[model samples]
Target: MAIAKGYAATDASKPLTPFTFERREPNADDVVIDIKFAGICHSDIHTVRNEWKNAVYPIVPGHEIAGIVSAVGSAVTRFKAGDRVGVGCFVDSCVGCAARDLDREQYMPGLVGTYNDFEADGKTRTQGGYSDSIVVKEGYVMSIPDNLPLDASAPLLCAGITLYSPLRHWNAGPGKKVAIVGMGGLGHMGVKLGAAMGADITVLSQSLSKKEDGLKLGAKEYYATSDEETFKKLAGTFDLIICTVSAEIDWNAYLGLLKVDGAFVVVGIPENAIPVHAFSLVPGRKSISGSMIGSIKETQEMLDFCGKHNIVSEIETINIQQVNEAYERVLKSDVRYRFVIDIASLAA
Candidate 1:
């Protein structure tokens, strides 16, 4: 076993605190990483608080990880010591399944999440990247591009791939009018990637609060969803709408904004279910779909795409000790985008 240190929520109601743990020693295909940064995701809060009902106690919640390899197993060939790498939402899955080959490991029969889930052995709980070190199979780790800063690149592992997978699946690109709902971590990434893919980008946020930031992030238009006229104006105007907001919204109203055969892709998991009318999809042949984070292969492709396009997430770096406060700010939507914890602080 390898000694590891991280911040963990010991119980549902408590704040995350320094906790010491152990990790399995490297297997023949494992790569050991000294974590540098771990992005705090909204789902981290939900899972820690037991809002998702899948919460596992003593949870070290983090998936958006960026670090440098400190060692590699004897059979590893994809990476070596001192190489930049990252691990995302998933750490293991049924790789032999056809779903895995299609980059649909999330749908695999037994997918292992980075944290709060059990491993294949069915007893060892999988800890995540919110730690000083992690050992993952080489197939699950991705090479981070030299052009991207490890800190800012951390969120790309989760939020970045979350948006990229859907956009790529929905074929959001040139001649497409893409509307990103919300202006936070996931939405901002959607805006950037959509625009980069040559789609005309529109930000449909709660209000004009982050309008300027949205436009600066590559949105061609920004509309306040609070204004009734805003919905009227954009009705039947978008080829795709990506809803990144986790709160319950008027789903039917947003559906009304879609053009014929347009899709509304949901990336955020709201605490409460929002009712959707069949008529919403019936009219205009629209569809509402949901996407999870990408598979390992596609996540690597997303990193390569972001690197090629000079794309990286906008982030606020916080020390590991500030994680609790960061969660509060995240709930208030006070963060400009994503918050990444500098893991070196954990060692301190």
Candidate 2:
């Protein structure tokens, strides 16, 4: 067993604090990573506070991870010592299962999350990137491009891929009008990626405060969602709408903005269910769909796509000691975009 240092919530409603735990020695297919940075995700707050029923206690919450390869099992061939790499929301899945694809192992009956869940072995609870080190299968890890800094690249594992998958799936490209709801972590990435894909990008934000930033990030248009007139003007204007806000939204109002046969893709997981009436979709043949993080194959494709376009998340770097405070700011939407933890500060 290898001793690892991390921060963990001793129980629900408790702040994360310093903790020590053990990691299994690397198997032949595993690659040991020395974690460099971790991103603070809103879902981390929900799970730590027990807002999400499936959350397990003493959980170490983090999925956006970036690091360097420190050691590789003898059988590992994809990476070597000193390689830059990253791990996302999951670590391992059943590779032999039917649902498993070349890019993702099937985890329908049982999926091992990056944290707060048990591994296939059943005895060990999987910890996450909140720690100083991790051992993941080579197949599940991705190569971080040398052009992108590791800190900003961390959130790409989650927020970046979350938006990219839907954009690609729905074919947001040249001549398509794409509207991204919310201007925070995920939305900002949506704007950049959507624009990079040759779409006419717009930002639908609650206020005009982020309008300038949104435009700078590739949005060709910005509108305040709080304004009644804004909705009237955009009615039947968009080909695709990506909502990244976790709060309950006026679904019908947003749906009204979609053009005929358009789609509204949801990536946020709201705490409570919001009622969706059938009328919202029936009239224009509008569609509402949801997406999880991308498949491992898709994630790699996203990274390559971003790398090719020189795209990366806009982040505010915080020290490890400020992690709890960062959580508070995230709740208030006080972050400029995303918060990335500098693990070097953990040594302090």
Candidate 3:
């Protein structure tokens, strides 16, 4: 076992504190990463606060991990020392399944999370990347392209893939009229990627305060939900509407924005069940769906695509000591987009 240093929440009500724990020794197919940066995801906040029903103590919550390979297990063939790589939400799953795409692994009954989840062994709990180093199996680790810097590329492991999976599945590309609801981390990526795919992009934010950033990110038009007329004007105007915020949205109202056969897809999680009137979809035969983060194969594809397009989440780098304050800022939607922890500060 190797001692790893990181910050952890001992309980839901208290602040996270520095903690040291032992990680399982590497196996033949494992790769030990010298973690350089870890992105703060809203899901990490939910898990740490025990809002998701299952709260694990001493949880080291981070999955958007980027770093360099420090050591490789004896049988490791995919990577060598000094190679850049990343680990997303999941670290492992039920070994062999009938699913051929591998991108479907997250749906497997035994999907193991990078943090607050158990490995396939069932005895060892998984710790995430808010630490100085991590040991992940070679197959589960993704390659970080040369063009994308490690820190900025960290959040792509989660936010990038979460938005990309749905866009790809819904075929948001050339000639399509796409609307991204919310201009935060996920929404901005939706605009960038949707535009790169050749779609006509629009931003439907809660307010016009971010209109400039939205347009700069590739949205051709921007509207604020605060304006009742915005909804009335955009009725049946979009082929695809991607909802990225967790706060409850008027299901029937947003559903009204979809054209005939258009899709209203949600990637964010709200605490309460949404109330939708059937009339919202009855008129246009519209459909509503939800998406989870992508599978390992799809995550790699998203990263490669981001590399090709020169895309990365707009990030504000923070040190480990600033994590609690950062969490509060995230709650207020105060970040420009995403927050990345410079892991080097842990060893300072």
Candidate 4:
């Protein structure tokens, strides 16, 4: 076993503070990474605050992780010391099979979260990347291309993969009109990726506050969702509409924006259940569905695609101690885009 240092929220109401913990020693198939940067995902905030009402106290909340391989156990062959890598939302799965490059583990019955959940053992809780280091099986790690910087590339583990999976699944490509709702962390990445795929990209935001940023990020058009005319003008316009906002919205109205036989895919989790009128989908044969993050294979594909296209998140780097302030800013949607914690602050 190895001792680890990190920041954790003792309970829902308490802010995160420095804490000490343990990591399982590297097994022959495991790789130990010296965490470099950890992105502050909105999901991390929700879990720590017990907003989902299933949080485990003293939880270290982070899943978008980028790091350098510090050590590899004897059987590890995929990585060695000093390789750039990333770990996304999970560590292990329920299949009872442990091997390098586990297949589609995210959908398996025993899927384990990177934090606030149990490992495959159902006893030893799995912590996250808001720490000095992480020990994961070699299969769960991803290689970061040299072109992508550690800090900005960190969010791709969660935010990047989250959007990529849906876009690719829906075949957002040349000739496809795609609309991304909201302009926050997930929305911004969706714009970049959707545009890169040659889809005609549009951004539907509540306000025009980030319109310039949206256009610069590759959105062909940006609309203020607040304008009733905006929705009316764009009705039956998009082939695919991806709603990235976590807040409850008029889903039926958004569904009306899709063309006949078009699809509406949701990646964000709204606290409240969405009510959809039958007419929303009956007339056009439009489909409304949800997609989780990508499989490990697809995540690697997303990374490679991003690497080739010079895609990385727009992020603000902060010292680890500033996480509490960052969290508050994130909730207020005050961040320019994303916040990445510089793990060196923890080392200090």
Best by TM-score: 3
Show the colliding residue pairs in model 2: 103-297
Clashing residue pairs in candidate 4 (N, C-alpha, C atoms within 3 angstroms): none
lDDT of 2 by residue, 1-348 (tens): 899898999887778998889988899999999999999888888888888788777887789999999999999999999999999998877756525455434224456799998888998889998899999988789998888889999999999999998999899999999999999999999999999999999999999999999999999999999999989999999999999997887888999999999999989987678677789899889999988888888888888888899999999999888999999999899998999999888888
lDDT of 4 by residue, 196-303 (tens): 999999999999999999999999999999999988999999999999997878899899999999999989888788898889999999999998887888889999
Alpha-carbon lDDT of model 1: 0.91
Q: In model 2, which range of ten residues has the least summed lDDT?
A: 98-107
Task: State the lDDT of candidate 3 residue by residue for 1-348, as single tens digits.
Answer: 999999998899888899999988999999999999999999999999999978878899999999999999999999999999999999888777515546688777778899998888888989999998899988789999999999999999999999999899999999999999999978988998899998999999999999999999999999999999998999999999999998977878999989999999989998898887889888899999999998899999999999999999999999999999999999999998999999999987
Cα TM-score per model = 0.97, 0.97, 0.98, 0.97
The collision pairs in model 3 are: none
How many residue pairs clash in model 4?
Answer: 0
Cα lDDT over the full model 3:
0.92
Q: What residue runs in model 2 are displaced by over 4 Å at the alpha carbon?
A: 98-100, 103-107
lDDT of each candidate versus the true structure: 0.91, 0.90, 0.92, 0.92
Provide the lDDT at 171 for model 3. Answer: 96
Q: After superposing candidate 4 on the true structure, give the runs of residues whose Cα lies further than 4 Å from its correct spot.
A: 96-104
RMSD of each: 1.2, 1.4, 1.0, 1.7
RMSD to native, candidate 1: 1.2
lDDT of 1 at 281: 91
lDDT minimum window of 10 residues, candidate 4: 95-104
